[model samples]
Target: MVILTQACPIQRPFGSHLYKRRRDFQLLDKRSWSLKPLIPRVSEDQDTDYQLRAVAKLLADEMTANGQVIGIGTGVAVNEYLREISERLGDGRLSGVRCIPSSDVSASEAAFLGVPLTTIEDVNGNVDLMVDVADELDLENLAYIVGRGDNGPQANQPSLPRVRQLLEKARVRVVVVDIAKTGRRLGGSVPVLIEANEDIWEDIAEELDDIFIGDAEIRRRSVNPDAGPRGGNSPVITTDGNMVLDVQFLEGLKLFGKDEIYDRIVAEIETVDGVLEHGLVVGVARKAVVGTVVVSAIGEDGQEEVKEESGPRVVHL
Candidate 1:
């Protein structure tokens, strides 16, 4: 009975002209590719907060029903969704809706929001739904990249393996992001968290560089720890004491068509000597709720005028 329904009509999304839903999609077909140049766009805009709130509200409605046990992910978009769910629970509109947060930050935030919390083990891995956010998303496929952009180690990142396991355990998985985050191809580096013999990490990085089109740099912690790391030589360590290697693609891997390099990497990257996990999430999200931006029109004064309205679209994956 858990289904995604739009509470309101969504404004035409930014990339409607570029992306269309098709049942059968090919990864390497140039004819099937609508791949645009991956330009750097800001996910945070003037209307972003509004759009996020709207997306949060849309998901909260159905997620609250049937006493569902939800799996929450990290980042600001997921935080907003948590806020919406929390408010509904507080007002007595929702009950028996427990949550399993992906990271410590989400867990603390959920506690602060007065939403009851549970674990995957506590629920015996029977999560009704998993809701998360993405850094960049391929609208053509449900594939996405999570985690902050190659910024050493994310303070809020839980065990990457655990996060992946939770996503796999869920009955349904949904990713919510700003429309700006969607594109023809996903950009950014793929983080490889490794736990191996100290001497072999350099060899692994060298091997990764040979396989991919970019450098695979081992991440370092912030030297100052207050104003962000300007330059540091110390390797950034994970909570689990694993080392992180961020494989930054200089030009992007879309030249060979969608998911070519990415799929190959995802399948074989772990086979590398030291890799524990990587951040290239492929086709995991079954649905997405994307927040639209404010539409604009030319005014009488020959100036662009921003409209007050924007909405969220429930995209089938």
Candidate 2:
């Protein structure tokens, strides 16, 4: 068993706990919310599009009219929800609400609908709310393995820094997601992606073997058309002009006793030359609102039963 040591405990932003409680809000309306029965319907068997729709409705309910919303990413799931929200607001109802999209792709889509564009810096330190999709999340509600869309780093560049700075100042931050992402243990299901500098790629890869009990490989990202000709066929690119290495464990490897794994990976690999940001996303969001989709099933007696399954749910944070 590999035991990684912790150099420093992650400090909780002051007043984070208080802000977490205060900011947390539920969007489901008991009166209006309804789930189609599964016995004859089998909604869960069909894909999680309904879950995504539910999440969109929930967001629309929570958002105030004529308010600013910061949207992150251009993934299919995120885009679908954004479209639903836009349609719900329709013409003049949300005219005063400006949507600051994190990625160019998202900005283009939102702009087509007359949604005003704002830079991430515009919402710096004081965004009314932010909605984004994630790759993985753990029990601590800490996110790992992000940046699926080619534009994640750029979109988050301004907003994330300012948000963290404000957390130190106001001491509050909120994150929201679906229940499926809330894993029981860290690293068991979700693979961690480490973004490092391309200069020391080989050295960092070698060090990961000593620090973790799993296989670690650099992430190769293909440049998108919008990124222009400067983008290369490099495997990974860090948010701060670095590289990304995706670490995966052998099948059936439990993530127990790996609390300090990130610390060791950071301490050892960061020492190498040309290393940049690791994919550790702890303390980024102080609070999370996890949305769950409950599919209804009709039993033989013609009664409806709600069944809960993990995954296949749209998330926001």
Candidate 3:
């Protein structure tokens, strides 16, 4: 839960119109913004759900051997990937693949769909490959921003350090995301998340400004009761009982150098007392499953019709 919401976009992206349900979504500066594009738009008709399946099938081709351990990341598109994997395994085309989910939400969904599941602590072997989602990705630099999901997954990110440890144990890493999620520049009102022990949140919040790249602000996410049980008037807690703080660059935001901006910001933040983890993940994925958009031109009169003309693009990392 990050409370730094930029000014509302004129219209949200096509595939990103999902409703928010978590009670911890209260924004601190609801009207703050940098007057820059938050997320670049794609003109093509986006069928991300379909594209995600296409990518999953491409991944299924790798589950050839028995007892493959796969790492699943959080995001709206993960369900689509899970469904595809479950179907393939059920049909006997794939076999003996146990999944390691990054979040509580992911574990429940994987089990409900009948996908074999295990935890990082229980697994005896390395993960074959990890297929997860990203919030903002710059393919050229292999840069990624994860854990910006709308609701539960946002809270789920406090567990990312554990996921990273497991990711290191994987032979390969892959990120599957709709192409609409990619952006050219690395700055804006993008949130940089932090998780720490609940008792030390205030200390961490006070030190955020020292590490921020520009005019960024931080706020602890609070939960309201009506939204859900785990959510209430108290500040929302991660599954690990940690407090979450969202650091959003408010204005004068700019990120250009390869690792200069990202690395410096992350390094400084990590040095902050009580800070445990942040949302920046870089150079891990060896492959990218990009869901491309194919927009058809308008004919004679002004009429629009959609069709799935292209499949996802698979780029080597």
- lDDT (CA) per prediction: 0.58, 0.40, 0.52
Give the alpha carbon lDDT tens digit for every residue of 1-317 in model 3.
Answer: 43322222222211132223212232222111100011112435645455555555544653224677888877555676688778878888678888888888888889999999987668765676566666666654456666643435345552566556655666555554445556544443333344545455555565554334235655565565343312234766677666666665554333221324454455555657676666666552233333342221111132322222345344444
Models 1 onward score TM values of: 0.69, 0.54, 0.67
Model 3 CA RMSD to the hidden true structure, in angstroms: 13.8
Evaluate model 1: give its lDDT.
0.58
Tell me the tens digit of each residue's lDDT in model 2 across 1-317.
23334222222211121111111222222211111211111245545676566555544554334665454444455565567657756855554566655455666677776556665456563445455444444534344434434335434322233223322322112233344545633443222233444455554554443333333322333344333211255443434344444444443223222444333333444444444444444432222223244332222243433343333232233
TM-score of 3: 0.67
lDDT of candidate 1 over 92-190, digit per residue (tens): 888889999887788999999988999889988888777766667777655677664342336776567766876677755566555566766666666
Model 3: per-residue Cα lDDT at residue 116: 90
Q: Per-residue error at 295 for model 3, in Å?
A: 21
Candidate 1 all-Cα RMSD = 14.7
Candidate 2 at residue 255, lDDT?
Answer: 24
Q: Model 2: runs farther than 4 Å from truth?
A: 1-47, 140-144, 148-181, 188-199, 213-242, 251-273, 283-317
Q: Please give the range of 10 consecutive residues that has the lowest summed lDDT in model 2.
A: 32-41
Candidate 3 clash pair list: 223-232
Off by over 4 Å in 3: 1-46, 62-65, 151-158, 188-199, 224-233, 251-259, 284-317
